[model samples]
Target: MRAFLRFKNSLSLAFVAFFATTSLVSSEIADFTAFDVNLTLALLRKDQKIEVVVRDQVTDGCWTKSNAAKTAVEKNLIIAGYENIVPADDNAFFTIEVSALGYDTGGNNCAVYVSLRAISGEADRYYMNDHEVMAINLREQFSSSTLLTGPKSDMTSRINDTLYEKSDELIVAINAARNSLRKKISDTTISEQKKNGLLSAFSLD
Candidate 1:
């Protein structure tokens, strides 16, 4: 009887540990493809206006040596008309970090990976941190090239093309994440009055 009880306790402990680890992983690297923009926007409709700031430190790796990631962020954000506010704004805001950007030209040919994080608010009031990763491959274009041999210019061209192709997708992810954060703030920290005040102050009402 004692042996069975010990076994049960061990299993319970292992299950708890497994669940904790799974939750941590899920919170750390959420894929943007799974984002629900409509739901998040609905949740944020009445909340405070938010600001955006882009991080300068773009992730560097094999394919990122050419500033492809940074260029993509600048181009896409500009196209989307996203305004980067200063510190004096005093409203709810989020900073975008380009956490990962790289390419792999091995095994099955070419692959591009991009990761972004949206860190909401500032200081103690800060509440939400969301992350998303997008990875794509060019098997159709590079499957025949076993050596992956290409000039720097050619690689740059391919990288730019891929980044442009995924630019709209990245914008969608950012929009979804921003709305999700607004929803979180609405549900948890800020009061209705504060939200209304913020909206009024920003002339968004």
Candidate 2:
């Protein structure tokens, strides 16, 4: 009987040790969503007449992604020194939509798909569409045998990280697409004075 009790105690200690290690790993991942919006905005320049709109369907109940798009637009305006441009949406020559495609979970992984589309004019189709996929490496915390049985807290943290990564990608894609629009506007045959005025206002020089 004493030997059996000793064996049970050993199992209990091992279980505790395993969970403690898991908690430590989870803390190391950090929360990516906490810093993504501000970081992305800092990296983008306000050098174009582009408006940012985060689709409601994508950002619904997702504050991190929503703030990312919102902050990017605000930062772009600030960087261009055009904060005075009221009703930016109406005056903007181009609109960029940041949308969330969907989420995928299986195969020991969590994946999120994000898309960006640029549109101009009432009849003009989207001039650019870009997609980015962000994923969390679940293998580090889960194995095939225990994939679906991991701690909920760990899984939630991983998903947050993926969402944040995807938001950052959207920011980069929008900036690049907006640059393309800028080049297209510059190449047009508009009058020099009008072109220069628009360009200067947008800080596109």
Candidate 3:
């Protein structure tokens, strides 16, 4: 009986350890994704140009509203003081791709999925096929879904509101990163030339 009890306790301990490891892994993944996102946002400068592309995958008779979605996203970006372009010109520093999937449920209820991806135009080297290859290096994404119930106009307004909120969130994060960079620049331990180089990299000059 004592042996059985010991085995049972060991099993319980093993389960606890397994769960603790799983939780730690999940936290690490969240932190990694957030770090990448902040890094991408931090690279943006006020004078840099961005491109916005919208894709609509709605099949519930709401595909026609894709144009409106694109317009709303562009308007929000412009309002946030980010210059937005179409067709992704050569001068664009980053490209934001917006993918939207919408469904029209019964009784004027609608479900929408909105995703945004930011990709930097800068390229970096990576190893593949036993050789070095260069490709666009930075990318990050965010997505959310919600249900709306209202008239067509009201629904449109809600969608635009969501876009505005997301744009604001992005700008806020970018500003936070900029503030952090500025703080680093003011650190007295760093050499003056290194500080100036950092400023130039971020276009703070």
lDDT: which is higher, 1 or 2?
2
> How do the residues 11-71 of candidate 3 rate in per-residue lDDT, one tens digit apiece?
3343244334333222333222222234345545455567777776755554445566667
RMSD of each: 16.8, 26.5, 15.8
How many residue pairs in model 1 have overlapping backbones? 0
Candidate 3: stretches off by over 4 Å: 1-39, 61-64, 89-93, 128-130, 141-153
lDDT of each: 0.38, 0.39, 0.55
Residue-level lDDT tens digits of model 2 in 23-124: 221332122111122211222334434556655342222223454555554565455453532344454434555454333244443333444444432111
- Per-candidate TM-scores read 0.34, 0.32, 0.63
Question: lDDT winner among the candidates?
Answer: 3
Lowest lDDT 10-residue stretch of candidate 1: 137-146
**Positional deviation of 175 in candidate 2, in angstroms?**
10
- Regions of model 1 farther than 4 Å from truth: 1-65, 83-94, 99-108, 125-167, 173-203
Per-residue C-alpha lDDT of model 1 across residues 1-205, encoded as one tens digit per residue: 2332343344334324433433321331121111232222222222323333332222223353435555565566666765443242554333334433334455434444433443443111123465443222111100111122333335445554544445455466546555664454344344577555533432334
